[model samples]
Target: MTAKEGVATGSVPSATPTEVADLARVEDRISFLYFERCSVSQADNSITVTDDRGTIRIPAATLSVLLLGPGTKISHKAMVAIGENGSTVVWVGERGVRMYAAGRPLTHSSSLLQRQAALVSNRRSRLAVARAMYQMRFPGEDTGGLTMQQLRGREGARIRNVYRRLSKETGVAWDRRAYDPDAYEDGTEINKALSAAHTCLYGVVHAVIVALGCSPGLGFVHTGHERSFVYDIADLYKAELSIPVAFRTVAEEPVDIGSAVRHAMRNVLYDFSLMDRAVRDIKALLNDDGMADLGGPEENHVGLWDEKVGEVAAGRQYGPDDGE
Candidate 1:
């Protein structure tokens, strides 16, 4: 099914003979599946699929992307069948009926790993950029004058304020105590918190892509992690978009505790447009890299992570310490 310009929604016609044959042919391609706006019914070991048009019986193994669109219902047994297939079934509408496929090829494990590596690399790159920007924004500050602990404290406050604003705008709640600058006194705690924050943001991006039936691992900005390019793409927004918005929100309206800060953040998440802009910016970056044709059924280039690692290893391989 395809949606033309300005169409609010589109419908999938009943599967033709060729489409049915294609489904059968690709049955064994992956162990996971996703479904949208469809239903599956089970009788013993076999399953029957019902749509607005009619019903068809097929072996349980032949099913993937089992969609149950709005107003559609499925028995607990059917839900179990769907889960047992290792499929990620999405509820697209109210009635538990509309759904679509969010599955990936089972053989794409290596791709998934490469995608993850790419994501990490992309994250580091963006973080480096943000850090550079921060340094430029405050160039006169003397690093030699302040202890490392003090610098981390300042960064923690900045990050916390940003999180508070993000929580207010996005309506996503996070622990406010998680942002305590003093907690980072030893420096280790702040680093761990940042890492955790990155992982959480990555998960949200992956979920969004799964909903769109896109491959998260096949990314435009964060290329190379096998099953998580979406995460990489999301990282680009963490500092520039999410952080600044979150901080601005917090500074404008003060919150006492971490939970309250998170509560404020939930409001920010309700605006999908902000998230959409972040995705668009990522796409723009990918276009600049001359890799706009990602996520297609073709091999991708070597990831940035691999290149950096290679550079570091080569330097060590030929370093003066090698003879020691």
Candidate 2:
């Protein structure tokens, strides 16, 4: 039997929504989800889904994940409803369905604590590297190269500058750093944590772009014809979303690096809820009128937003007024 079929008939008990309101409210939050093995059925004007936890019944909207047996069939009406709702529909084994609410709304507030921690940690690491680089590049100045304390100061300033820019652009004031690393950890340890966190953050960004409908290969900040700009956008969120969580996960779990670490990082891509925020934020940014026109018929039409449209227009091989 297929995995879907095995899940449907498996001895595992289904998971039920703890509260009906929880299910109803879920539509507004996470529009996408992963269900390992589950069953969905329609009865008495209500659709019920059974999983290892329990059974949940409510009005059917759009089901993105649907798994049915080889001979199973689905009605066109169901398919239409699913499509109309912008839900992703997946069919697997017999009598199994996984439904994810499409366009799931996300709030920065919900993840503020974790995001703030990540930002602070990342900023610290970046500043540390920058200070080291600066000292190496310019030795024996009046300052005798920046010390760890000086690095912290520079880190704070740079983070604040970036934070202010992001706030002005996005209208969100992120939390500032609260804890001092000198009181808690050494510089080398902090740097190591930061690197691991950054790698995980990159992974999350890639996942988010894939979830959102942007090709990762097209990029904005990291210039290269072959590079994925969407990946760059995702990278922007690493400091605010993924890094802190990865650090905490690694610190708390303390697992040795191996296949397990790789696997754990993959799971953390979804666990930290970075993908959800990535999709939501990217969609907003992409849909904005100020956003540069990235996808079009031009050969080098990279969608890098510039405040001065005339500058980009001048750089363009073909202007909007130019006739093809």
- Superposed by TM-score, candidate 2 places the C-alpha of residue 297 at a distance from the truth, in angstroms, of 25
Cα TM-score per model: 0.31, 0.31
lDDT, candidate 1, 30-52, per-residue tens: 21222334576655434567777
- Total residue pair clashes for candidate 1: 59
Off by over 4 Å in 1: 2-155, 162-175, 178-204, 208-275, 283-288, 294-324
lDDT of each: 0.41, 0.38
What would you estimate as the lDDT of candidate 2? 0.38
Q: Which stretches of candidate 2 lie over 4 Å from their true place?
A: 1-28, 40-49, 57-82, 88-217, 221-230, 254-287, 290-324
Output the lDDT of residue 80, model 1: 46
**TM-score between model 1 and native:** 0.31
